[model samples]
Target: MTATATIDEVVCLRPATSTDFDLAGVINSLLKPVYELPGAELVHHLSGIGDVGRMIQDALDEAPDDLYATGVPSSGTDHAVWPVGGTTVEAGAGARLAVGITLPVDGSQDIFLWDQDASSDDLLGSVTISEAEQGQGSLSKLAHSDEEHSYYYVNYHVD
Candidate 1:
């Protein structure tokens, strides 16, 4: 008799949880080029003197590089706050940080996430976001790391 794989068996073999995905090679693939980019020193230097750049460089230097991640609701609430590490990235003051948040969907919501410098808002990069039905109450977070800067804002509705 020949052995055959069932759908259930295949599904079981696939990664289904965040931890499973985090362990997979996907994060490495996504982050390697970012750290290996040419003129890393120049970028870091231009970023100025702060622990934010150092922290990012250190994280990149590690064997398995990992980006920080956090999640929030898809809807509700007129105003929301997103702290780098749930507070200022450092214990001391005068630390400068300029991290960006890459939203799962584009044009889904205007200015979905923004830093203190509202006039210079920018998106981080492209990321795969799973499809969810409307009003499903699904939660999605703008995932990324940060530095010595302050809070971020999440505006759900325009009006």
Candidate 2:
């Protein structure tokens, strides 16, 4: 008797981890989402020299093709100081930066990654400034223009 061809079933195998893997991510924000670190800051700055018109033109000329990232990210303190340190950019005519920071759900502590250089920036209004402007006068305009003004009454918690 001719042996009938036996129909067979086969199974493809996969690595244990691949099949039974554990992965986590915020798929859908249930209630205002959760961030390991929450808070967004909108920082605006004017870097360069010349009159308001010139400064604006210069800023625009030197503006990054992408306005969103014109300057590199430095410590809030350092970013503040850069304007005054150089002979190229006028001390007062340096960068005028502005950014908005959204406070974290877990208090200010869970906001920014408060690194070594970045202490809790005592905010002036909702805006956090560079270190140079700290301890100045009423606002950035007063601080950068006046020599007597120093220190800010605000801080950005980045821890």
Candidate 3:
């Protein structure tokens, strides 16, 4: 009989820091004109520009690490069982995915985490789950890059 592995959620304990700041600064500058428009001040005040700006600046201070995951049911296979392309999750947030993927009882799956960016994608880390690990469980992995480190928690179950 075949068993199915279900992905419950992926939690980001910490996000990676960005080394590229010039590009982000340039992008923010391009949006300055929008803030200079007439009535923009009123809108800004109504929307709490101080708070919004702080949040935007905070995000720009780090890598726009929009996270996503991919699960390969088996090694040497070009097929992916979950997230064909990817399902993006917010930085330092958890994505609850009740995606179930079926595999042979003796089969195993490798799950990878990635940070999606405009320039290029960064691989965060990966974890392998075997059918023998059936039942609810969580796995943790740390992804390191130059001076940045990212921590992730993956929760899943096989039955």
Candidate 4:
């Protein structure tokens, strides 16, 4: 028997509220467009419209958080790591890791989500899947930090 697990995507429900700033003091917020237009153009068009322009500019200046994943097979001591997608995924966006692994029939594997940061990587959450869970189909686990939460979806099978 063989057991396999595939990570489909990581969905961000709500990002951490605390601003993650780089050395330049820029906030790393969500990268997804909130205003539907380019940030610079939006700021330019909204300028002289009072604090609304400044508010929009501030929101646009924020950058999305970078994320990645890791899978540790029960039979091995090393972890297989993969990037979620590009450099970052904004809140409310889903990033596809598409990482898969095969194991022995009786084996199990642990999957982890992490936020890559300039200082240090932060562990978002983790879940374990075993051969016993085969045929259960898709599984989702919600992992969270102090102020952020994300959903990790995986597909498991045994053959």
Candidate 5:
């Protein structure tokens, strides 16, 4: 008998025997975007992304009224750029890279990844970091690409 399953509406694989089946192989082939929840609710900005990350946190630490007055904390709006954290790295082609990001609030946040080397700062894509994520953790493949050295700028905020 053969075992088969439908994965992500694409790719079908059959296993001749249960013992011979490789689950890891199937997971690796599925290149679908994953949306994950945060491990903990974050009330403060995560540290260690350099100065911009700190400055954004400073602006957000102010009172809501003050934030509104200064227009620095751009929370609760679409298309708003909130500084979460960022890093630049060099990796081999098709290598999986892990990035740790900390976000504020116990709500949904969008994580944006950009290629700084590009003229337009080309946006690759975004993944939603759910409330289940902790203030600090590692996300795989934020640096995943075919390029020998990838330059990434990551930013995100609660929405």
Candidate 6:
């Protein structure tokens, strides 16, 4: 019955429920890193950038390819950073945070949270959590943490 007034910053919710949405499977094994495909077939390799929410920070600190994520489009194996575009379901608040993202073609997801008040672009920290298949690492750290902000997801059919 109510909506945020401006696109200056917005949250967009995905389909609430999907016949295709397998919460159990996703929890078990849906979002797994993509390794089967040859690296050539890899559209891109996602890298989690830390504390890079500011556009000015991007200029001061070089991105992986030494290019800016805000400028230029994703091309070839550029390995550029892109914000994933979608809605993030926040716990407790029952309020969804609208998110924008550009990620790899596979299960590996680079997590980014935009902070409106702190930075101009409105982002805070960068944490990279790969497909759950990574087993244990930073991804596991966030997964196992008491709480987490957002995640990049993929949908696969078990049937």
Top candidate, metric TM-score:
3
Model 2 alpha-carbon miss at residue 11, Å = 62
For each candidate, the alpha-carbon lDDT, in order, equals 0.26, 0.20, 0.51, 0.45, 0.26, 0.24
- Give the per-residue lDDT of model 5 (tens digit) for 34-97: 2121211111122222443234223323111100000122222232232223333332211123
After TM-score superposition, what is the CA distance of residue 112 in candidate 5 from its true location, in Å?
A: 0.7
How displaced is residue 118 in candidate 4, in Å? 1.1
- Candidate 5 is scored at a TM of 0.30
- lDDT for model 6, please: 0.24
Instruction: Name the regions of candidate 6 deviating beyond 4 angstroms.
Output: 1-92, 97-108, 117-119, 131-159
Model 3, 26: alpha-carbon shift in Å? 29
Inter-residue clash pairs, candidate 4: 29-63
What TM-score would each prediction reach against the true structure? 0.20, 0.16, 0.53, 0.51, 0.30, 0.22
Cα displacement (Å) at residue 18, model 1? 27
lDDT, residue 21, candidate 1: 29
User: lDDT winner among the candidates?
Assistant: 3
Per-residue alpha-carbon lDDT of model 1 for 6-41, expressed as tens digits?
Answer: 110000001111232233344445434443343223
List model 6 lDDT by residue over 1-159, tens digit each: 111111011111111111233442343242234322322112123212232222212332312111112212222113323332322232111112232332332444433333222122222223343444332211111111112122212211110
Runs in model 3 deviating more than 4 A are 20-60, 72-87, 93-106, 136-148
Better of 1 and 6 by TM-score: 6
Per-prediction backbone clash count: 0, 43, 0, 1, 8, 11
Compared with the true structure, what per-residue lDDT tens digits does model 3 show for residues 1-159? 456766655544335656465644564466445433433223325245445433544665654456666564232112334444545655542222344444444577677667766766676667777777766454332332323444455556677
Would you give me the overall lDDT of model 5? 0.26
Order the numbered candidates by lDDT, best leading: 3, 4, 1, 5, 6, 2
On TM-score, who's better, 4 or 5? 4
Better of 1 and 6 by lDDT: 1
Model 4 over residues 71-126: C-alpha lDDT tens digits?
64221112325542334333322323344545454577677666656666556566
Better of 1 and 5 by TM-score: 5
Candidate 5, superposed: residue stretches over 4 Å from native: 1-87, 132-159
Tell how far residue 29 is off in model 3, in angstroms: 35
Assess candidate 2 and give its lDDT.
0.20
Compared with the true structure, model 6 gives a TM-score of: 0.22
